[model samples]
Target: MPEPPPLTNHGKTMTSVFSLLGRNENDLTAALGWTLRSSPKFLAALTGALSPAPQARTTRIDLEVSDQLGRTDLELHGADHAIVIEAKRGWLLPTVTQLETYASRCGSAPIAHLVTLSDCSPDWAQMHLPAIVGEVKVTHLPWSVVGERLASARRTSAGHERLWLDQLDIYLKEALRVVEVNNAEAYCVVISNDRPGGGGPHTYREIVEQGYYYYPYGWGRGWPAIPPNFLAFRWEGYVQRVHRVLDYEVIPSLQDRWPDIPVLSESSGDRARSDVTDRPHVLCRLGPALRMDPLPTGINYRANRLWVLLDQLYTAPTLQAAQRESQVLRGDAVADESASI
Candidate 1:
């Protein structure tokens, strides 16, 4: 097997106070609270992202408020509006009960909203979290979106505010595992395709012919938070072909994004495809398919998907070798390798 490429830092590097303070959920909540308290413009931008428009004025910002129901991560009270924010470190989804309890506190305000900030995508939240708990409207704002809003607000800011925004942006990306920008150190996702034992709408022929691959978009689904730069098709007990990801789209259905492609479902059994066909999917348009040496399947591989460093995928002789190389690159121990993927 050929040697793997050397790992190098690709994106902008910056120092963040949050990074020094042990970046966790509490730190994230505190940083967000501070940002809101320090900058009214940022607060307005955040409020605008939520439904029912921006609040007139933010009267108070509180962190880690404990009550009979549960401890709310952060709370923002404004004239006629109350916004409760629950911050999770990574892709952790907020429980319905926890959200409902937070919603209970918002009853006093004329306009109430519950927002959840996490690395999980909006589509995942929509599929998992309830839209409304009682009267208060529920919204899941991905940290990526929050970072974008803050960056936008920072462009017009100056001095300490702009500096803080820059730090916060870096912190959010590093700490919260927000959408990863494509770079030289990009990875490839190896996806399972339909076969005799595996049942799905996407057969090997369909994917090769269509010039695209898709994964169901939701929490616990195999889709990556950010689309990988490359995709490897794992079928027939080996990785048959690899393709560069030209572009991607998240859509409710195949026809919704590509009207020409017929909506397809499994021909046998329960027709499981029907259950997911109407739901959101991440469709990745591919560049020319590149056939590779058949990388043999390995035991302990992830059920439907696995992540491999692009260089490793190209050079490693076996699936397990690629996974091991990726694990080393990610600094994950043998036991924790699967968990990280």
Candidate 2:
């Protein structure tokens, strides 16, 4: 038999955090168990989400409850449900039949769910999940949805309990990085001033401040076939930062004022107002401003630049790192100012 690769330090840390055997104990399955046992607020949230009857508390929280099939991550007994959760930190999605086995083992419990850090589940799981496995109603929840529920629970919690819940939120947001920024259908538009009439950074900043995104009516076919929550990047000659994360309403024609238009005229040295108005234009509402720097080196600036594909913008590594740094910087600044005072 071949030896499996040793767990990395980070993996070990995750195991320690999630395991049922106290903080020093290393177990990958501890997190759900600990939260359910220790955090009353979280338990309440979980149970409420799982069932209508709120679980005030649980009598038992069993970790790695096994059946003929496999071990479940955490099993909460003596609550509103014989709730079984399979928590996964990485992208490894659960098989539908595997979940069905856990659900079957849950027995008379009306609610069972699989919680994972992945943004989505597999196609087969998606199609087959929520189906009854024995009497248990199976549910699939992503970490972000779970985090929001926990956050709601945190408000009602207090002291150390609240502190623990807060820690869970931080863990979900930072350690897990499970909070998805874009919808599954959302896409990227890595556009720059590719033509004589295309806008620049000054125009990009104006669009950002004004809270509207504009494209010339004659730019392309009727509204770039993209879903809402699409990202728009501004390539400022040197670097590309996210100009806007956007959701749009089509203006149909330049004359339609459903979404307010920018002041322009035939005198702007672009297309004639009358000439442009004949074509449909997109009146997009700008979303959150993001700051990401130094995208994948040597991007193609010509040919297909209008719909330049940069899927990594959804992850936006630099922006997230910058945001974290800003939080720390703000805290330090506050401390310095307080000391000076």
Candidate 3:
């Protein structure tokens, strides 16, 4: 029997095995466990990130280990420390009971830690999960952070180590939707009216005609750290227009920023009671709307604010198609000309 070809070799001809295997929680856990077991440097980096103090050397990597409480997704048994991991798909988090149960399995190791890996943000996870379950310290690690750390580790690695880390990083971003906006070559922000159907000053029509868009500062609303090259407006279940970002400014109020425009002044009056008119806002000035087909929004699309690659948004037939195409272009799957969107 011949030895199987390396994972890197398969990238040119077929979709990544990691991407295919990562479709479900169990499979994803197995894939991650395999990576940690195969790559010593990656494992060390992960453990170091998980622990404040240096972790004891990992001696074993176990998957779906059975116990009285439940089966843990993955476990790293170190010489003096033990780490129990519960992997969840999508934005799901492990139940409190599940976390406590897994924490119990950590035993008498000097450093016992319980970690949950999912698409949910770390802050969100921290709010939901207990800081500590018995003697075991608990924490949430977002897949996005894992992907970023892998990319960072890969930068200094060589040979097979670098290749494996590269594939896993791509798998996390492409298949799991653990994307980092900063990594994109060129991306656009898609914004929608706070109240889509309700008559308002910031209506899609008003924004298009006025050639500007503004979002209130802070409170989970703001622009990306990396300024987007384009701004897209979504309304009536479609992305109606995309505009090149001409310029932007942080202003105390809409009136302060563009008092000369009567429509904007009227908008300021409408928002007076809400205090939004007086609050600081990121006022983004934009170029004329691009002439293109309106991309129909998908049923699963829920975000009022989201980011999409500029090229993908322009080239894809639908909003969903744009997202899928972006994943493929990022190396999540093999690009097939005949493949249906």
Candidate 4:
């Protein structure tokens, strides 16, 4: 991976700090947040759409299909998605060289679409993208439309995207075990910089003091099964309550617990708006945090699909087939082979 672009400018302007917020992450949450209640196609494709967003916190594959002649922009592992973007930017446009490199990296993954934020020839994107991404639906929105400028890859002081894959593999193992709609562990959001009210983390600690999350008694996605004994954070003027506060030991940083990244509060100018909240905030008390601004209600987080699947599977009359299928499906039997059945 190429080194991350240095924060350009003499480090002036809110753009240096707030520009990340403006970067078009291709985030489904944010995109839908902007487009939903209007575009039904986007609404239907919400989950997958957001999956490719930069800050999903979901770790993915990395490949930069460089030309035999030269290396260019990076290509994250992207297949089985509906869109592919050849938005090959920076010093490598106006030719098939960059596109070929990216397409090479695309090896074997089903291509659904391609989009390019770069000012490549329309003929190039329109004609070549489908072939390059192979079946991924292709659309090249201008960088102005996609909202990405200033290109480069993530880097650490160690240089390069220096994450330990071995650690990530273990993290995924633990995450898979707890990612189900049922039996999910609680998530913690940091408040290190907040000017807390009486509620905040103290409320969560109080809930923990009362044993709210004790041994499978709690639920996520909605309000805490127990109330009045919960904690709430005060932002602006709204009081956002915790569903189940926990003393968790997530192997990765606490940031990974929530399925999404927290967007910045337009009202507050903090470096980050808030933590990716564990469960959606319960409206146990509402006056303290910003009220007019509502929170998201996502059923995917420990509320919707998996438990329903389990309930029906467990109750099916043909117990043998369901059990066998469950074993194959859940026991790490090959995903492709298992899906065929």
Best candidate per lDDT, number?
1
Native-to-model Cα distance after best TM-score fit, residue 282 in candidate 3, in Å: 20
What's the lDDT for all of these models?
Answer: 0.72, 0.51, 0.68, 0.31
The local distance difference test score of model 3 is 0.68
Candidate 4 global TM-score: 0.24
Task: Score residue 156 of candidate 3 by CA lDDT.
Answer: 84
Model 1 per-residue lDDT tens digits across residues 212-315? 77666663344575567777776656777777778665666655754544444445457555234555667778888776787786644554466677677668
- Structural similarity to truth (TM-score) of each candidate: 0.67, 0.46, 0.55, 0.24
lDDT of 2 at 296: 42
Lowest summed lDDT window (length 10), candidate 3: 332-341
Residue 185 displacement in candidate 2 (angstroms): 23
lDDT of 3 by residue, 94-161 (tens): 88888877877788988888989986667557767889898789978888777766766787888887
Better lDDT candidate (1, 2): 1
Better of 1 and 4 by lDDT: 1
The local lDDT score (0 to 100) that residue 324 gets in candidate 3 is: 65
For model 4, residues 1-341, the per-residue Cα lDDT tens digits are 99666665446332222233332222222222333223323323322333333323212322233456554232333334323244333212334444444444445554333445443335434644453333233445543232221111112112221222222222222322223334322221212233222123434334333333221112233323332222322222222233423222211222232223242222434432223233223322212221223222221121111111232232334322333455555564433212211
Candidate 2: tens digits of C-alpha lDDT, residues 3-87: 6555346455432233223332123346555665678778877667653453445688887777678877777776445666676
Q: Rank the candidates by lDDT, best first.
A: 1, 3, 2, 4
Off by over 4 Å in 3: 1-13, 19-22, 178-341
Pitting candidate 2 against candidate 3, the one with the higher TM-score is 3
Q: In the order shown, what is each candidate's alpha-carbon RMSD?
A: 7.6, 15.5, 11.1, 23.7
